[model samples]
Target: MDSGLENIVAAETVLSDVDGQAGRLIIRGWPVETLAADKPYAAVLGLLWDGFFPELGDDAEIQAQLGRARAAAFALVGTFPMESGVVEALRTGWSLLNDSEAFDDAIAFPAAAAVFTAAAVRHGQGLPLIAPDPALSQAQDLLRMMRGTPASDAEARALDAYLATVSDHGLNASTFAARVIASTRAGLGSAVLGGISALKGPLHGGAPGPVLDMVDDIGTPDAAERWIDAALARGERLMGFGHRVYRVRDPRADALKAAVSKLPGTAGRIAFAEHIETVVLQRLARKYPNRRLETNVEFYTAVLLEALDIPREAFTAIFATGRVLGWIAHASEQIGEKRIVRPKSVYRGPVPEYA
Candidate 1:
């Protein structure tokens, strides 16, 4: 059996598809690039929920529901103590949600839960939790919460673009984990919690934060080559270079880089990151020659998020904020299809012998 079921097709889905060789991602018939620029998070949510929640209300109603739900979640944050990491706080907040009476079959139910959970976790760390503004979009609200105030139009727009860009990819590790949990007929909250848990691992959503760490350690473009070289020699996997899906550069990398361009103060970081990218690529090409270790999504993710003033500890939580849309959509799709996702594994050890 392949560890972690690599290369396994566990479910049939009409969700997003990850074309690694082509460096493309298609979400519900739209290219990720189409949504990554200026599309509000709420709009993308509607798109992701397509064919799953046909009865979902209009944008205004959905936004109102999200705001109400977020406010409700804010009140509960005080009940769960904040000691573990942000991911743990998110998970615990979601677990507490299981007791909510308003948790019926409403479309806004899960969305609200995720927003509040993320905000509460951040708030518990003594950061102010900005209440959701019906006047703002989902991405804007997230940024507002993280920054303890309203985001500038450019900042909000950049974050919206980033969130839309990463909202979904065809059945990546976290999505797979969500689907596995959903296969048991668990609630959407449980599935999303599973997804968040999977993403918290360093190999997945946690990589972006360390990319910044790597950049900070290198301190200069001239030092990047030596730093990466030493790390490679020690057998440490470069944090932001490779991907499980894409053999080449991640398409999302370019998309996010472009999105952050419109924001002020991002230019310098972008240039520095580009220099690091060049150094890393040049060193890798000279050293390995055959291995296709190109920049993946995490490389630019660190730069952009850091420029936005997002704390490194909060990186994975923010990732979850974007990915929850995809998780909810997939969960709804799985439930509608009436399929229990079970896969058979071939046993390799000695079988029982007949006497």
Candidate 2:
């Protein structure tokens, strides 16, 4: 009866592995650092969906197909009202993909799902959803659709880097949720939707947005230590500072910080964030000598996404957009094995009642 299933190995997988103690993530035989340095989002997708998706031409062909699918999804966003929350809008838009005759393939699933989710959320805000251009990369196309204009080369590359870095992580909550859905023989879209639902939880995807809120409240670097100290004194958890898994700083933090550095006007914000990080670390070390409250991925995720012009509320949805690739890959991996993901539970409640 391990509460929360700690240390449980519910399923076997060949997907990415999260090594918290080592502060490392290995994805499909490649270190995350190597992938971030050399590959684009399309290439990472290729690696993740290797065994599941049949040889889908090359990176160029996959990019083109995804662009076309995105445009198709954008056209359908108007059918669903945008007044609903982003998750609901995304879920509703995903149902529309079922109308397509060729929605079963793994390759097509992620491409269309990314498009539909982004467009649906944007459309719900009464914003115009841009059509995807086959000429552009997936990251650029996503930026174009979200911003209603083509992203600058730096912005495009920054986003590409972010998507590539975040495309997958070893069996995290969302990926596990995705695997559970896929084990039921549900389609890729269903699995991805399940992943998104899990990511929407505050403990997961909700942290990044609150990082921005925390920064805004602090107003200046000089005030960071005091603000964080007061919050801690009040029994409040500081957003973006600690991680559940990593004892040291999150490696993804460095990757995202580098990516955001390429965006215009981001240097100053990065510097300010660095100051906050320094203050928080110093304060935490002094206040709780035994605690390891290091900077986590959410710290820089907030800065990078904010620099990319993504609205605070849209952070999780955008996270879902990138992580959808990993979700699909895990789902396919689970389906290939054809096993149910039901884990055993230790019942501690009352015995059977008399009927």
Segments in model 2 whose C-alpha atoms lie over 4 Å from true places: 99-104, 117-125, 352-355
Tens digits of per-residue lDDT for model 2, 1-355: 6666648777666767778877887778887767766677677777777777666657777777776766666677678765767666766666666521122345555566556656765766777666677677877777777777778888877777677677888678888898898888877777877888888888888998889999999998878878988987897877888777788877888888888887889888999999988888887888789988898888988998888787776777777767888888888888878788888777789898898
Scored against the true structure, residue 182 in model 1 reaches a CA lDDT of 71
Cα deviation in Å at residue 238, candidate 2?
A: 1.1
Question: For each candidate, what is the lDDT?
Answer: 0.75, 0.76
| Candidate 2 similarity to native, TM-score | 0.93
Encode model 1's per-residue lDDT on 89-207: one tens digit a residue.
77777776652112234344445544654565566576655566655666667667667777888887787777888889878888888777776778877787788888888777888
Model 1 residue-pair collision total: 0
